[model samples]
Target chain A: MTDLLRFRTDAAHEEPAVSLDAFVEGQANASAVRLEAGDDARVLIPYLDRIMLVEIGFPKFRDGRGYSSARILREAGYTGELRAAGDVLVDQIDFMRRCGFDAFAPDAPIDEAVLTRSLERYDYHYQPAADAIVPVWKLRHG
Target chain B: MYKYDQYDQSIVDARVDEFRDQARRRLAGEITEDQFKPLRLKNGLYLQLHAYMLRVAIPYGTLDSRQMRKLAYIARTYDRGYGHFTTRQNIQYNWIKLEEAPDILADLATVEMHAIQTSGESIRNVSSDQYAGASADEIADPRPWAELIRQATTFHPEFSYLPRKFKIAVIASAEDRAAMRLHDIGLRLVANDAGDLGFEVYVGGGMGRTPFIAPLIRAFLPVDHLFSYCEAVLRVWNRTARRDNIHKQRVKILVHQMGAEAFAAAVEAEWQEILPNKSDVPRAEFDRIAAYFTPPAFEAGDREPDRADPDFAVWLDQNVKPHKHPGYAIVNISLKPIGGIPGDASADQIDLMADLAERHSFDELRVTHAQNIVLPHVRKADLYTIWQALVDAGLAESNLDLISDIIACPGLDYCSLANARSIPVAQKIATRFAGRQRDLGELKLKISGCINACGHHHAGHIGILGVDKKGTENYQLLLGGSGAEDASLGKITGPGFSEDGIVDAIERVTDQYIAVRQDGERFLDTYRRVGMDGFKEAIYG
Candidate 1:
């Protein structure tokens, strides 16, 4: 396994990710799964407790379906490591983090200083998401 | 106009800081242009023909004297002496710098303004009726709701990077002044049988290469479900909209493919799922926002407006409309001057208009979808003084809704995407029809430099689209379209014509209308009554 950003406490998985069909076939032993942009995240919700890591693919950075995919999995109570892999950039880090991406495996390596600056930039957010950041509206009203 | 609170202020301030950093990095060659383009575009900065064009959001077409004055300051300091108000009711500065763009946004932040989401493939600005609060025809003011939509959509986590740009419009009237049906999502505030207010939601209406009138998705959605319902709509489109073909990515195309019935059903199912989780705006928070838009204390104004001057009388006849309050009137300010740019407002003119708003209009002003301005709450007695001020400022044009009042895009002269110049064509058409403008009456002529339809040529009563024909510029004329309650797409009259020939072609169409029109019929009415058959014959022959 190549170097990847991880927020999870456990050691990184050594096994290669299996396809969604393969994971569903071996749900009892399957610990890592991969989802393409077109795969439905809802189908894996029942087996989320057994899975330790889920890698979602993005063929291009401009295709935003991966954000929706990450959000759907996290909001459905997936506590395992959610890794965003392929064609990601420093700019999308802030949004990907907000959408519950705990790990990143970009096709191109990102600069650590720029990544830190992007993630720590905004203290407030406009909308509630899968992340722990309270939406600006809640703070205002309270 | 809604004022930004401390929360709003902090968010805007943070955005300015973030943009400043991004601009610094882009300038220092840390990121490539392909990477920096989408980020700058989200903040309303665009690379145009000669310079970077910056589009500043005028939320729901509403702003105050203070905000308006700040706009003038930005125009004078950062840009050329003028800014162009767009058909979407936002203002565009054509000559912006990549370096100074961040400073411009910082300056706008001081006046409770930012250029966020004015462009790019995310949700763009939320527009509403210019006459939202003051008009008699509306069920209620739509500004508060527009502001809510504005806030919720800003920096939305999941739907931030849409396949194509999304536009949402909110209106509370039967008379459609904001081109509500031409947006990606349109909401009309209405009343149920129980007399409770809600929205009639329309999804998938837009114009570009393909023009569609949004179909009704919900007849009456409850008022409290505003955020949840909209979230459902956005999520459905975001997840399912085609990413393969950029042209077929808009929600309108998706709606057509899925069929309106199936699309609405999908939205309803998503909305039902969202309802159990409960993410709608709180009633108290909604009421808190609504309090800002309450009516100002209005004294009984003079019943009669002085019309001793013929120019004032003509201006009053065309530019003024009855407000809900009998004492006041809604005054439409014409940005279009014959033989000039349709929507260009100079620094001096902008300042003067701001002063007028401060003095006589409860400090409020609105930018209309027709690229005009409106002092929504004005005393009828102060009409003469305002007219004189406008006359001195070269803005007292008595051609409201007339042929000279054209809606045009900043075409090849400024925009990088344009195939021909829309402004020069608009200037020529306005000047040619100046003498007979009042006689022809209420011709909503619109021009676009390309098929992108930024000028809303698809909705014009007399639509002119400028196309690139081989190596030369060409223009096509279409007849019989309306963007009102009687909305219909226009039909092309004939083959293309030269730049000069199109102006003459327009005149011939009007001449035919005058010859065969019935009593009290406007140009649109005339065109609608007699279809494109006769107009095509006259123009083509």
Candidate 2:
């Protein structure tokens, strides 16, 4: 099992990290927190310092609380490495980056070239995130 | 309608791909049905009585011709050549296959649409008046605010797991066409003393087994604080709303138990704690969002009365309504025939409407909760031609406020929760009262599939509720229910009737109202004065 999942964005001054295992059973968490294990917010904020890797827990990718959580963590001052862990597929990597995740860890082994191509599927930036990337709204407004 | 920027498009595209992968996993036995049910529902896919049903969101009931055409395409290709426009202003394709749903969702994503939050115990589609931006009496267009609210509420971490589903409706006009009074949160845009827009917010109002008109929580809330205030309300509801009993889980029941004043006080306390937070909508952001909804450049025309064309005059009296613009009229496209289903529109009809909207109405069309469509911004000069086209398309019946223009839910035919069939009841009532529409005047008929009251029968002037009597279908009639400014639940008159006898019983009540009404009074007014006694006798006797 991969112990660390790294998430780095262009906006980060240095690499920042989080650990999925420490996030799973934290003392500051409540029952609702455990129920929402796939949520990044639960582990993202508390485990920001000592961790260098974060997992995108897709109990099921259809349950997209993880995507929003990943975005939230990235927005809330996390910058290191992000990995899509369980149920992660080749198609979701492009969006994962737009939402602020940087690394892809598909359930099955993925070819690096194919994964890179997936990241290049869309050439435009749209959503605002920790990456400080120029968004489509800025282009339109400017 | 607000066009989706690339951000919106990307999110929808990503979501579609995600659902497609999820569907593959389900097929591969990677996820159980229990695990996949909520997942599918969050994407607006439902496993109904027989097959999967896909509900496509029509945000705030505002759709342009292009979106409508896409919906038409979906109906023709993926569905049974027809779609049902729901009370929440979304369209549902009931006969959808589980395997085909992913492709359908992909098709929808291409149009910058998705079914996210249309179901599940989270914020459902935010609905507003179909005549939202186009209504003449509106203080301001409410769609931008609705859109802002939609964004604020969509997948908010704290709100995704609420006690029950939440519904919010915003209406800017004095006449509450969106039935704001029956929503979980009803926002009425109001102008303050300085002629600036604010909201008169109502909370805890909903219809189901126990119907309650939302009580006024805040008479006037600053427009800038809309998001924060809503956040406060939801937070309070999440913490206190009942979760033990599914029947009493709605915020309405909680409000009823605690009383509206106490509920409002609790919400106020919560709001006080969060007043200085980032959730407070910044003035700049409000202005930015509101800019998208600025009315199109409407040339000022003569306010002087022209000699009314006889046909145009009749159409105006029955269908066209006053617009805030001097020369423009808000036109209703009647979905009801003399005897037809309340909200079902064929693929062909949908296509024709798209064409008509593009040609005559600034490329905008609105699907009302009343199961009718509105070409909300038609000019007076073009009204005659538009009316002719609508008539040619078999859509012009001039029954805007008539008895046949009923609100009926997809009862037992579609919904698993229904106790009895409501469509046939609505059809029978419409047919029975077709000849007497002119005499019936402004009667509002609302029918519910079951006591859940999706049809909003409880709030209708003539409310029909379908009930199951030991295994047989029976119907109950309720009188004097109004979903207007002075909204009230209808009072059940007497005994429930067999399905066959119910329409005649309604006809008898209508005949009674006609005979005893004092000079052009509506059925509701007359029912209020004489009470249910006279109507009960007329129906039962």
Candidate 3:
């Protein structure tokens, strides 16, 4: 089991995540779901409002499929606890959060001080994404 | 050259700081090499076969004298006294220190430059036509748009981490000088029937294990929808591009497997979803950026250059091109001298080019995709003087588009990825054909160390791919491919050859081309006209 960092005010679910296949096939009654890198997030759109936790597996940090997966779920109105699980590094925290991952579950321990510093390093962004952070372009336009 | 705004400076500054911490952590053993690799690559520091190579972005291949001087300083201070300009219009220092990487980036930041997005899985430098504004045939200057795209793509939140590296090239003219069709996203600025300038977008074209000419996904995309439409394309590619096979992960493979039409349809669907967002930079923002690129005042003078010097006459015809404005010429300073390593520029040469750019060409210079330099706007009257200066500096090579003007990658000599060395092969071939390369006419001889095709052998008219065969270096020759408007992949001729044998084989192929080629037909044209049967027979028979 890995430690989870939750950012939402909603009641957290302690239930184990059902495999994406089981959940998509309606064979599982779980509210928490696990998404492998290859799993399509589009299939879970109908059940997004009901899901309390959605864990995206990053088998390797270099394999960036989970970033897109997290973005797709958030854009599709999956307001659940989007967690980035496995191989998550301190440097990738900011990008994962920008892609709508509000929770992190690293396979290895990350230094909290370094993670915090990295996250707060930049106040300006080039483009708007799954996050509410206003792009610098918007500031100029306004 | 686009100057960095407050937002731009902040982002770059923050990145340098982040990289500084990461480097420190690595030094302290807090991060492993596997973890440190991506972080270092994102900042353009690569641990190569011998040392760390730092690739600094020359955005859209455009840089001013100050930036060039800074690059010279970095080359002298950080590594050796030289740097290699890549085919992607970026510069790489061969012997960089990991400890000095952060300091180099900090130094780059002072000149409003950083290596952000120059490497890693995200977007590399957004390359464009080296002769952007000065070229006679361009519809509009492509650099402004390239700059806009550069800013938006720089440290882009969702796209910082991608399945594979993405490359974008923008061009505005009918003549594809920038290899527009050979990028992951190739944007050619065009005007519609309504006269509104937009782009004819091509996606998934790349040169690697599998070379492709990116299909036309959109015939005309309005300038307003540039980012949203791009987002759709990237998003689709991000989620759908194959991650299973490292070789098959480029967006080109996805487009190939899905078929062009189906890929376009998918992008269209995604575009519709994101259209309401209006993610592209506003008109005011574009105008602000465009203001930086507006050409300075020019004095009208004699259009015809004095051609009394025969050597000057040859160079004027070969190296000088007609600029958009009368009396102005686009000067191509070929880095390829006879027996010199392709793309290797000494600190002295870099500083000289900078001085020439400042004095003769409005303080602006461009690094060509073919590993040359261009002073985009020089008065025709100053041609003789400029030519004399280049001659003095050993920069006057009258071989633009000629056989001796080779494009070779730093192969086994520097790159860990290479199977065989490419520099010696290029030197041997160039030396062999030095006397007759001019007669050959427009032969794009490219070399790659391996199938990754950094040398762009796939797109070369006479291409060579170097590979490892049973612990020895082997070379493969290819023909009939081009990276121009009519882009096509080269086909392998026959059996591989040894280093010396490949050079001899090229001679035979070129000799055959001379015999069979019609009047005014170049190597590629002859290859296309007569087909591969003749060339293969010449090589084998």
Candidate 4:
């Protein structure tokens, strides 16, 4: 767990979310659940009120469904931890963060220094997304 | 041209720094090649057969003189002394090294250009007609809208990681010069009965191995609601478009599989939720972007015809197109210099063209989908002078839409994906038809070294596709395709040819076209009337 390059500022302090098998087995007591990349986020939307964490699977870095899943859950008013697990890498951390991925559990170890630099790569972004960073367009016109 | 403000400039500048760091990581082995591939591709870097090719975005086919000069500078410094303008109205440098890509991007940022999303499985550079603002038949300039869409989709979180790459083209004229019907999302800016501008949205159109003329999704959408509607379509695609199969993943396939009605229903349902309390672009933002694209000041005057030389007359007839302004002309500078590669322009030629653009075309120019450059707002009186300069520089080849003007992809010569060499095939064909170009009359000969159709062979009137057979390069010929207003896919004729044999086949096809006496029909028109049988027999029989 310590080897993972977590993008969220408070990722180290947070408890790990339950995997899909664990969640399914302990459905009544689970506070957090991990979902595979293919799992429809819409199904989890109804349960989002009580879920403290919603860990989405990446499966592969090139498979971008997790990004959409995180955005969907965030848009559906899920304030829980949206962790990107499996195959997450240093290069994807910033984009993952923008799409509401607050925690990461990469399958492989990442250089902490490289991950940190990648996260702070840009001060501004052009598109308005799940992140708090003000879009360049809003900064310009306002 | 849309001048980048502090924010826009900062985004591009920051991207350069980011890419520089990513390159460092890749070089240091912090990331594997598999990890670095998509990262570099998203930044418009490709590892080709010869070297890393860097594609720079020429947003909506428009660039100022400063940007043009910077492109020339990039060509001179980071790459070989030349760059290729692509069919998507973007430029690609074929001789880039991985180490120098960041520096090239940083240099491009100074001129408010970038390689961002130029080559990736994301929203590509939004293309419009090269003659977008200058064309006489336009209802309204589509540049502003194209710019708006470009800005919105630049780093869109949800869309950045879609199943496949998406392309959007906008056209305002009745004539679809941008090939609007052949995009993932084609927005035709049309006026309603009240004369207010709206979009005739077409979706799912594309060309690859599977070509589709995008069907009309929403016949007319109010201008203000465009962003939300577009988001709905993309949202539907992201969630539902096939991710399991890479080849069956474009929105076109989904549209076909789900049926247009069902797809429209899904989009409508999504749009309903998004319409209220939406993240759609506001009117104020639209106005702000639109202000940048306001027409340049032109002294209103009558058409003044100058005494033109015979060569100038030939060029005028071939390259010059109608402009909205009375005394202005849209000049297409042919990149297809006879027997040369179709779209390659040397650094010196680029610089000279930049100088010409500054002097005669209001300091701005456009890159056409046909791999030509446009001085979009050239005054009619200055045509002769521009023509003379172009002729002197060897840029003036009076073969626009003629037989010698071929559109070819960087096939086995550069592209790692290619099975054969398209440039040499194009070169030989152009040379074969060099003397008889004008007489051959308005034949679009497009060549792609593979089925990816990078050269858009599917849209060429006389299309040549390269293939691999038993470790040998083979060329397949197709006819009667078009990318213009009346969009149609070309049909392949029987059998493939060796490289020289293909050129000979093309010669025989043209010979047959000349033999069939039609009063004044163009090559495409004659082909459309005669069908593939006549051309097939002429080539194969």
Candidate 5:
């Protein structure tokens, strides 16, 4: 077991064991789906409710398709584990978490202390994301 | 000026603490240099040629007297005793140290300012017209929307790791002082036939090796839906922009390869999906932001305008801009001293300008996209006093929009990416045209040390691009470009020239314009009327 830190508040109590079964695209009966940087996230929307974890690949640190993929999966009502695998960095922890990513499988070892501190860097942000913290504008007016 | 509320205050304070930690980690050898590069860049710290350059945002070119004084303090204490105001409406210190970066940011946070997003592949500071609120010809003040956009785009989650850096420019006047047509996303506040305020949206306009004017994507979009529509556009760009090549990753390349019509269609499709509930700026939120921009109080003024001193009259003719109010005038402080760098100001000059702003222009000043400063609401009666003070301090150069007022990037001297030296060339040209600028009349000379076009070379009446040809510095000359309401790209005329040869070539081109020009034709007009052949013949024949 990879001592993974699950970030999704709503999905924390779910079962942690998820077999990495390969689900080829356009195949009908695979259990879970995987996405590359070039693949469209909408192709997995129909199977989101049934999928256990949707693994998105970040081939390079600068390629940001995983962030969009994670947001799209959550927007399509996926409550399962959305794991960001490959080439993830410690600095992108908060961004990945706010974009609806629950678990990370970075290519390098992540310092848990730095990761925790990074996620708590700003309690509030200017834009509304998947995180539940109120945007600063709402806090100001409300 | 927009004052920071409690929420704004807390956000900036938290960011300062966060960057402090990040800088600590980077210096402690915890994170690798590759991992820490983007982190520092997002906070506007760049590893340049000599040292780290810190670019602090001015937030739509508007700053208060206290903020200006703080900037002066930072310049005096942190780095050297000067700062450079860039063409992007931000100020840069070229000699910041890595260790003191956190303290500098913490000090900036006291005044609700930060270096955040001034660099990196994120949405940077949203710029607007420097004369936004005070211009007589404006339809409405555009700074409110600029502020709102800045708030919305700051640290946006999805677009943070963008394919390339993004920029947005907003303008309300028919005159294009802000160079709106040359930004990634340009918003013009326009009125429809029904007399409702709306935005005319333009996308993919940029200047680099490949220069292009933005194409209009939406003729008119309702003002209430501005944020949602912008979200839709950025979302579309974020999802589909080219990621294979860093050079081809800007939204401009997407717009070019996919065609504007196809890009617009894609954005519309994304917008249709996003508009239902993803993004919307509530009426209360809009009003709350707009409240900060309500016009300042004005008293009844004397009907007669002062026209007494000849020196003051000359300054008025060159530097004073028309105000929306009759008795008030907008004063533009020229940063382009004769044979000097375009926008470098010393610590004392910064403090003096701050004091001048507090006393003469309602405690606020604006930085123009052309790298000049503006005291937006100066009374006509105080013009003489202000002019005298400016003259004493060496800030009173009477060359607004003149040939000597050049826009130049900090080229080979400081920038790690420069191909040739731009400052020396600019100095040479300015000195060459010092006494002849008034006669030259309304000529904009722009210089870029490389093809990145930071000085907006493509938009100048005369554009000079410095290139390294076979281990020697060579320059290419272009003519007939304007960043005004009638925006057009300049055309290159034949071959390149050496540094001295290029200056002489420019003079030759101008001399031809002077000889064959009809009554009262500006350089651009005469070039447009006579076309490129006349200048080509003058230079080569």
Candidate 6:
């Protein structure tokens, strides 16, 4: 990460909903959990109820196992807050949202204006994600 | 051909500016060779064995006369008075100075052309059939969609940092002339029974150290969903493709390990979640792009002349093809000459072709995957004049799709990955088969420097694979291969041959075919009719 970009975390606002640095690993954690169909309800139910934030690891930028983990958690009714951690970049924020990440912790500082501009860069939408946004086709044709 | 809009022009201009800055920094010693290496590559500048080679992108193999003339100017000014058209539908100048490279790029930008992303891990040039808009057998013109895909994928944020290089090709015809099946992702334009336009998507087919033909992921994907589907595919690949071993980083390896079914499932799942998002291609946008590729106004006439002038007839039989328009024909300009470098066009020849393209053709030129140039739309009446000009320029040889019209990679002479020199082998074979052109009919001789198959030797009717043998060069011969309608990989016949022995071995194989073929049967057809047994026996015997 020699040419890496960094962003500072805001610690003044009541610890916030999700910390950019935390790495979540439990079965109930949206970003790092891997669950089987037959997991015990006792363990799953309690963990699902208690966890409020989850951190997704990229491991390497290409290794997207964490994206699936986040999506599965979102589908499984975990609605607290989702944040991306390791190897995050400005370019991946749109995809991160589609995979159920609500907040991103890109290695570079968050340029709110730039981020806002990028969020609306392309008006067309596709794929069913946590955002449930309407694709451009539906807006025009439907 | 798709014309460049403001966005396309701006992008090229910006890229030239960026490369100029990088060149300046490198000259000033602000960056080390290692640091500047990838940066230069991303801008399509390669430090080859001799000098810096600059590869200029000809998107989807389509270019107008203006761009072609500009290429000629660059060739005359910055290069060794010649340029090589590569298998990727790009042109490479072998002798480019670091100082002059930026100026050349600036000149190219004037005609809305620049050599960006022609090399490097980023999305390389998107290639399509050279006969894209005019081929008679094509279902629809694939250029507009190819252009859309090119625009969407260029400098795409999520895909810029992939595990390895990625390539995508689109074919709109029944025959895969562009060899789309051998790319990272192959898109075949097709119309469903319901008359809906869509694509048959193939994933992970590529030629490299590890060669794999792409596998089908979807039977039919609607045209509007093109971007979204492609996005889903890249996301899955970017996430799961191997990273540790550079050799195993291509999407093909991942697709192989995951199996096409599992890979398709992963893509579907990702698509399901993202289909509701903001990246899908809109129908209007598709129309906007497609409108640019509409066929030019054609005058109706009998394509066949009363008696077909002998020379024109010979050229038509070999070089001209049936165009979508009845009166027009697609003219394939063969770059391969007997004992000459495949794909090399001198500045004078380039300028001559450009002038002819403007006067007789539709002012358009295309670079084919087989290392040749093409004039996509030429009128039947202008055939003789065009042929005469081509002959005067030393371009007309009436050897299109012939043995001497070989496809060869720039082997040890240029490539860092080559084990043997490919150009010399190509030269030897071409010379051996020269003057005997009438004897050797409709045979494709393709040679690759290494197994990476840059020259597509595996798909040739007579395939030549160059390998290093105990610090010496050797060539292996493969027969019964086809890159067209019935595409199949060639299988090795027997033991490898030394450089001197390879030409003789190829001669033997051709002689076997000449003896065994039915009247007027193609080499590939003959090989298929009587399997490799006969050809193998002749070679090994």
Best by DockQ: 3
Tens digits of per-residue lDDT for model 6, A9-123 = 4321123333222323322234233222122112333456565555555654444455655655665677655666555644456656766777555554554554555465544
Give a tens-digit lDDT track for model 3, residues B14-104.
Answer: 9889999999999999999989999989888898999998999999999999999999999899878999988999999999888888999
Q: Tens-digit lDDT track for model 5 on B177-215?
A: 988989999999999999999999999989988888989
DockQ of 6: 0.13
**Candidate 3, residue B228: lDDT:** 84
Q: All models: lDDT?
A: 0.89, 0.77, 0.90, 0.86, 0.86, 0.76
Instruction: List clashing residue pairs in candidate 5.
Output: none
C-alpha lDDT (0 to 100) for residue B117 of candidate 3: 79
Model 3, A67-125: lDDT tens digits are 87887788887787998999998899898899999988899887889988988999799
TM-score of every candidate: 0.98, 0.82, 0.98, 0.96, 0.97, 0.84
Interface RMSD of 2: 7.0
Give the Cα error of residue A74 in candidate 4, in Å.
1.1
Tens-digit lDDT string for candidate 1 (B1-541): 6888888998899899889989999999998899899999999999998999999999999999999999999999999889999888899999998989989999999999999999999899999899988999999999989988899898887877888999999999999998888889999999998999999999999989899999999999998999889988888888888899989999999999999999999999988866764668788778889999999989875587877888899999999998999889999999998888999999999999999999999999999989999999998888888989999999999888888899998899988999989999999999899988889978899999999989889999999999999979999998877788787888888798899999999988999999998999988888877888767788887
lDDT of 4 at B88: 90
Ranking by lDDT: 3, 1, 5, 4, 2, 6
What are the per-model DockQ values? Answer: 0.66, 0.08, 0.73, 0.59, 0.61, 0.13
Q: What CAPRI class is candidate 5?
A: medium
DockQ of 1: 0.66
Ten-residue stretch with the least lDDT total in model 3 chain B:
B272-281
Clashing pairs in 2: A5-A53, A6-A81, A6-A82, A7-A80, A7-A81, A7-A82, A8-A80, A16-A79, A17-A51, B136-B324
Most accurate candidate by lDDT: 3
Q: Report the C-alpha displacement of residue A52, candidate 6, in angstroms.
A: 9.6
Candidate 2 off by > 4 Å: A1-142, B300-313
Candidate 6 lDDT, B77-159, residue by residue in tens: 88878999998999999889999888988998898787777887777889998988888788988998888787777655446
